[model samples]
Target: MKLPLFPLNAHVFPGGKLSLRIFEARYLRMIKERAGKEPCFAMGMLEDREGGAEVLPWATQVRMVDFSQLEDGLLGIVVEGVQWLHIEDITTDDDGLRWADCKPVSIWSEPNHEQDASINSALLSLFGQYPELGKLYPEAAGQSMDWSLQRWLEVLPIDAGNKVSLLNQLNSKPAFEFVNNLLHQGDP
Candidate 1:
């Protein structure tokens, strides 16, 4: 789908939560216009930096969940991860941020019963091994199995490139495998 773009060096995984500080004038305007009305938008990362502020050429989609204006006229917002997307084309304004044409590598679909069961069971197993996560994610034990799995994927602290790669994953098996590798430092 076509999306208004925000290019950054970081990646946001689907079902993840992102907190951002917006100080640039253009982005400030973008947020002011968007705020509560249109919380959903696309975000991408600059693989490389050119002389100007434009991104390298790709981006992902992101949705804004909560935002507030800081003392400096900047915006502090909470965003939820949506999907990984590739930029098909981009157009920039006077400021660095750009608008891009893009689409996700994998569209989200409601998990089936079997997938749900597997995810739930996996979470139970993971919690047993990594109980520390329970402090930050108290809901882990009570959330729907699918949502718990998705949240675990979202909180990953990797860069934008990795998030995009994970988004390209086609099935629950691959997605779970990728996340497992990440947890184990097995991904290269």
Candidate 2:
């Protein structure tokens, strides 16, 4: 399937949610046309926005969850990741919006690792500090390693290339181990 690509510096993984402030004319138009008829869109990681928005190959298909007019007058919309996709080809509209031929891909799978209580505890503590982030997930996403790993990947201030490497894996084992190591970094 094909969808409009919203190249962003920050990204969302499956079961993860992100809040975006829309201000660009092209993107505003995209939302205006897409909000009701087709509330689905794909977000690709734009590693270097300074140079230009060259979207990465892999992306997450997202659906508009809610929208509102921010006090700053910009459009604020919250979206939840629906599926992972690999963009096969891209074409730019005359208005500069990008459309991509994407095929569904699965990079996150249920790892055999047992539930780590600390993962949930740590993430909940983080959410307590940032209530806004917590509001994104109304469900108990921190209850499982599969869900927690995606949140950890999205929230951590890690390198984009590192994130891409971890995301490209076939299963969530690498990401789970990576997050576990990070959470227990100072342990003897």
Candidate 3:
């Protein structure tokens, strides 16, 4: 399906939440026009290649969950990842907005195992430390393996290139290993 693109320097995986500041005229117009009628957009991580800046193929289709005007007079929006998509073709509008034709990409399915208690505890502690992050997933159960991993992906300061590679995988094992190793690097 064809959708508007809102590529960023960051990433959000399926079932993740991201808060965005809408300021550019092109995007402002996009929000104004698309909100309510559709309220979904495809977001890919921006990358600087040797030629120019480009939006990577792996993207998440997010639905606007809430919006409010911030104190700085910018539109503050909270979006939730609905599905993962691989962008196929891109076209730029006259106003510099981008639109892409995309196909759904399979990501982690819910793991067969029960929720990891350690993950739940760790995430609760994390959210406690950063209440702003807590606000993003008010409805989460804080235990499912996929949910725990996706939150870690969004929370960490990993670069876009690594994120894209992790995202492009058909399953979550690589991601699980990556996050696990990173988090437990110094542990005995």
Question: Which model scores highest in lDDT?
Answer: 2
Task: Please provide, for model 2 over 134-170, each residue's C-alpha lDDT reduced to its tens digit, 9 standing for 90 to 100.
Answer: 8877675436777877788888988566787887786
Residue lDDT tens for model 3, 1-188: 99899998777777888889999999998888789755378887787778977788878888888999999999999888888888899999999999999999777543435345666567777888898988887776645776787788777888777776775666666777787787678998
lDDT of 3 at 13: 76
- Clashes per candidate, residues 3 or more apart or on different chains: 3, 0, 0
Candidate 3: misplaced stretches above 4 Å? 50-52, 109-115
Assess each prediction's global lDDT (C-alpha) against the native.
Answer: 0.60, 0.83, 0.80
In candidate 3 the C-alpha lDDT for residue 41 amounts to: 87
lDDT of 2 at 76: 99
Candidate 2's C-alpha lDDT? 0.83
Per-residue CA lDDT of model 1 for 1-188, tens digit only, reads 66667776655555655668888787887776666654367766655435645464455456787677778876788776666566788778777666777766653453434344555556667667766444334455556544554555545555445544544545355556665555557535
What does candidate 3 score on TM? 0.89
* Residue pairs with backbone overlap in model 3: none
